[model samples]
Target: MSDRTRNTPEMSQSAASRRVAKVGLDSLDNLWFQVGGTLCNLACEHCFISCSPQNDKFKMMSLAQIQPYLDEAVVLGVKEFYFTGGEPFLNDEIFDILEATLAIGPATVLTNGTIITNRRARELARLEANSIYSLEIRVSLDGFDEPSNDRLRGKGSFKLALNGITRLVEQGMLPILTAVQTWSEAEHERMLAGFKQLLADIGYTRPRFKIIPALDLGAYQQNKIGPAVTEYVTEEMLEDFDRSQLICSNSRMVTNSGVHVCPILIDYPDSRMGESLKATTGEYRLRHPACYTCYLSGAICSNFSSGGQSER
Candidate 1:
C-alpha cells in the first residue's frame, strides 16, 4: 500500500433505516472507458463483474464511441483517463484508443497481462514515448506463483502474464502489478514479500504493485464464497466525513450502454446515471451492497491510493 492511503477511516454503518447518503459529484477528475466491455480472455474466480469470453452483458466500445466522451471529459476538466474491460488488449482498436487518450491526457489501462506480444509492447512503448502525458498499464495477477495464481486466474496464466510483464519492462514501461487479496490479513506481509521476490527473480526490480480486496459480487456470489454485505451508507455517516473519498463524487464510467455512476456498479440498473457525461453530473445514491465496499475502502477505483489499499 502507498503511504498516501495508510490508516484511512472507514464509513460507519448503522442498523437503523436512516436516509441513504446522496453523494454529489465534486469534479470529473477521472474518466473511465469500458473499452473492452464485459468480454475478457480469462475469467478469474474472484472477478467482481464475472467477465468471460462469452460474457457480453456490456459490449466493447469503439474509438468513435469513446471520442465524444473524451472530448466532453476534457471540457469538464478531467485530469486522467482509464480503460478497462473483460480484457482491454482483446479489443482490436485498444492501442488506437490509448494513443488517442494519451494525446489529450494521462491514461491507464487495466489488463490481465496475457495479450502483450512483442509487437504490441513496441507499439505501446512508442505511444507512451510520443505522448506528453503519461500512459500507465495495470496488470492483474491474483497471486505470486502459478499454483496460487492459476488456481484463480486459470491454468498457465501465471507464465503468460509474467512473459507479458517482462516484455513490457523490456519496452521501458513500468507496469503496476495488481492482485486481489485472497488470503487472510495475517498473510498479507508474506504475500507482499513473495510477490516482490517473484518480480525480482524475473528481472523486474523495484516493482510497483497494489493489493485490492475482493468484492463479494459476480463470481464470488455465484461460487457462494461469501455472503453479500447488508450495510448501507446513511446521511448521518457523511456528516463530517470527506465526501471526496467516494468515487461517485469525482468519477464516471462510459460504456457502450451509457454513462454510469462508477466503474464498480455498471451492471446495476440504478447505476446508469444518464446518456451523457454532462447529464450525469448529479447526486448518486449509495443504494447497492457494493456501495458498502466502496465506503469501507475509500475511492477504490482511482490510480492513486486515496484512502483505500485496494484500487490501482
Candidate 2:
C-alpha cells in the first residue's frame, strides 16, 4: 500500500462530480525519476503503475537522459531525489544513476526487494558510504507470510523478499519495509505487530515500516483492492486547507516520456505537465481521480511520510 489511492470523501450527489481544484508548484524540493520505468520483476497486484517484466510502456532511463534533469534540479535547489519504476534494480545503470544523484542530494529508491543479491546489497552500502548524503532503500511487501504475501505479489516472493531484506540488514543497511494498508483500522496494530516479528526474525531488530494507503488505480482497482475514485478536490475544498500538504504543490516526477505532475498519476496522459522540470513548475489542476486519494492522505509518496491519512 503506498498507503495510497482511495480516500472516499463524503459529498452530496451534486458535489460528487465537482470541478478540479488548482494546485501550483510552490517550490521544487523533491524530484522523482521513473528510472526503472514500468519494468519490474514482479507484477504486484496493488501497483498503481501496473509495472512488470512484459509491461514496457515506459522504458528504463539511462544516465545520459537523467543528467540534464539532475543539472536542472541542482539549479532549482532541489533537496532530495527519488527513484522508482517497475523496480529500480531492473535498470543496469541504476547504480551509476544513484552514484550521480547522491553526489548532489539525498536519494531514495522504492523497490520490491526481489533481486537484492548479496553483491547488490554490498553495492548499496558502498554507495551510501561514498556519498555525503544518505541513501534510502524502501522495499515493498504485501503481507507477512508466504500465503498472504504471495497471493498478491507472486509465488515464492516471500522467501525472495525476506532474503533481500536479510542481505541488506547484514550489510548494515536498514531498508524500510513498505506495505499497502489492506487490513481494517482495528487490525492496524495487529498487522504491524506481525510485521515487526517478521523483521525481528530476519535480524532487523530496529525495523522501520511504511504503511502506504492503497491507491485505487491500475492493477489495484482492476483487482478490486479498493473502490473506484469518485471524488475530486474542488475549489471549496482548499478554502481552509494547507496547500503545502499536497505533493503536487512541490514535487514533479520524470519519466522517459516527460515530466509528470506526480508519480501516482503517471498512467494518465493528462498527468504529463511539461518537457522539463523548469517548464513544469506551474499551476496544476487536480483533475485526476488519484488527486482525491492525495487529498485524504497528505502526500502519500514521500519517504518522510509514515502514512498520513488522519488529516486533510
User: How do all models score by TM-score?
Assistant: 0.91, 0.92
Residues 158-198 of candidate 2 have per-residue lDDT tens digits of: 99999999999999998999999888899999899999999
Model 2 residue 227 distance off true place after TM-score fit, in angstroms: 2.1
**Per-residue lDDT of candidate 1, residues 105-141 (tens digit):** 9999999999899999899999999999888889998
How does candidate 2 score on lDDT? 0.86
Best by lDDT: 2
Error of 1 at 122 (Å): 1.1
**For each candidate, what is the lDDT?**
0.84, 0.86
Q: Candidate 1 lDDT (Cα, whole model)?
A: 0.84
